[model samples]
Target: MSEKTNQPLRICMISYRSNPHSGGQGVYIRNLAKALCELGHEVDVLAGPPDPLLEGAARLIPVETLDLYNPEALFRTPRLDELKDPVNLMEWIGTSTMGYPEPFTFGFRAVRHLKDQLHKYDIIHDNQSLSYGIEKLSRKIPTVATIHHPMTVDRRLAVRSVRAPWKKFKHLRWYSFIGMQKRVSRKLPKIITVSEFSKKDIAREYAIDPSRFSVVPNGISTELFHPMPAIPREPGRLIVTNSADMPLKGLYHLLEALHRVSLTHSVRLTVIGKAKEKGGIEKLIKKLNIAHLIDFTGRIDHHQFVREYAKASIAVVPSLYEGFGLPVGEAMATATPVISTTGGALPEVAGDAALLVPPGNSNALAKAICSLLDDPEKRKQLGAAGYNRVHEHFTWKNAAEKTVETYREVIRDYR
Candidate 1:
């Protein structure tokens, strides 16, 4: 509607889940909104399910969805009047059948919520919820979608990891919604992806022209993730952050590597996320007899997680695939040497500063860990390099500035 300028612009950010424990999307929303507000933009984050822990200048708009995974009331239903709309009814059925429906449902709700007040904001930014309803909103307002990475990559890796053909088939069925994402992503006029590696994968998977996408890397909150020079790291203590119990995360492999490392080195692994009681990771830890060597911290506060990072001699990102690798950047920002797998966008984020190993290869991971554990000089060099890399290239302020520029470019072209 108007030219982008030094004056503050009203912006609305949309996310299906803004829970920091859910995934990187929540952290992205929390930090980006704060950064944009710091840059003199009015920011509002409309989120569903889990609430985001955010500070001043950025407002939160909660949109409720039937959280089937909520521990207190699993499989609970929403009030009848709330589901009176025909589209909402369809979404409820779609989710009950077998496919994930929150993205589509949230998009429907977001469009209805913003339809009458379209003039209140300069732009609507969608955070990886590539729903058809998002396509509809793009027609009414200047919209930009940030795809962390393509879901197709996850489906592929999951299928590869499973032993049974039937299990592979089931994985395919669960990710069938990728078809809808592909359709919506192609139609969106503006897109902001986290890394160049993801830009290539998404363009290829969605059959879009590479030139149509823009790359704006996600940032690490240096305020929270920065190195603590006062606290000394414990000897042979390794840390890994895994948000989901998915095979694509490669945590199982990390557990195996840790088991091997313990034979020659007195090491312990501290996992910062939950591992289901009967999950693959838990079983593996027991089988390897590293149950005592591993300490699963379940979930911890942002400050405490960083404090754990401060105590870790090194952090490992053992994912089979990553769109942007926020954990790697976060560890790097904390001045912790990272040993990451060359899966998806990890190499792009790790750069040459951190040690790289092949995904799914536990032996290589063990070797890399042993090398880092033995060489303190190498660790010091990598830690410093990583810190400088993130500060120079991946702070939220820089990310917001680049994103704002992309927003202006898209609006100018659309107008």
Candidate 2:
């Protein structure tokens, strides 16, 4: 039943690209939109290539792009006519030059797409697409931006991960858009982020005022992630969501911990993601000789995810940093005990429901895993605590309510 408001809001939620299974941005868009709709608001998600799935009364408005980085045809050259459009040409040129130009180009494309309907939306919420074109929209309408975290962190971590001079240069070039983002974000009236840790870090890195940010945490999908009381837990089983070779994910450290755990216990790991072709993760598995102990579920639906969590003895999130740790919330929501690091907003999310270890510490992770494996009663206790914590604190309805509060603030403060 819709919680009809005195005044229903029309919101334009924009994302440059929102592939549902790709990452957090997609999950965020899908869940947040539904929650807003339930609160008696109309949400039109304006997104680019690789479409986003929507539930409830929220709608999707797709703006076509050259999509040079489409996984099906990554970095493919556009035809002469296709590149005739200035936006397409710029995006193509930027990609060819070892830079990511989608956010910048998507801004212009979004501008064109929304020009006819500018007055339809009460507020424009940018999902991290802080481009100059987005800045222009902020000037015309009440606009708010959600910077999931600082991309500057990712850039630094990525550049440091590569050894070769050229690889470092390429990584640096890819993140050059950060300069544009910082400028655009500063002009916006309000910003929403997932955690206070993100608010401080992004302000420090992007040079934006901390006062502009409202730390509204992301919510877990309890309907999808709740405990499966019917499925029996598998002994010595661990599950982790993977981000391939990204050093910031700290999967490498987790692999080391897994190897260490296997030496002392009968352990098996289930990865809810794929390892890229010849990627660092694929090579590392062979290096540790732990392939036989790990199962990679390339892509899974919500049902499979719940089943996997239901059977897992423990879930681990070993990210070196996270804007907000969704994995921690997901595990907890599923009534699975969690082991997370003191990385970024992880501890904020974990609270006291799970074990906490130092980021990038294999020995600590192994120790935590071993302790949980040997103590079933402790695991059960933590699992129930996590489950209780998620329901009591993190829910889409709450996140949506807080987000709407921010929306109203931006609307009232609009110049």
Best by TM-score: 2
Query: How high is the CA lDDT of each candidate model?
Result: 0.87, 0.91
Candidate 1 on 1-415: residue-level lDDT in tens? Answer: 6664656778889998778654889889989999999998898888887788766599988876667656668656766985787766766686676667778778888887787878988888999898887899899888999999999989888888789988887888778888989999999887899999999999999998899898999988888888888999998999998835698899988988998898999999888877887877777777898888877787677788888999999999999999999989999999999999999999999999899999999999999999999999999999999999998988899899999998887777778
After superposition on all CA atoms, what RMSD does each candidate show versus the true structure?
Answer: 1.8, 2.3
Expressed as tens digits, the lDDT of each residue in 172-229 for candidate 2 is 9999999999999988889999999999999999898899999999999998888999
- How much is 218 displaced in model 1, in angstroms? 1.2
Q: Which stretches of candidate 2 lie over 4 Å from their true place?
A: 1-6
Residues forming the 10-long window of minimal summed lDDT in candidate 1: 1-10
Q: What does the lDDT read for residue 267 in candidate 2?
A: 98
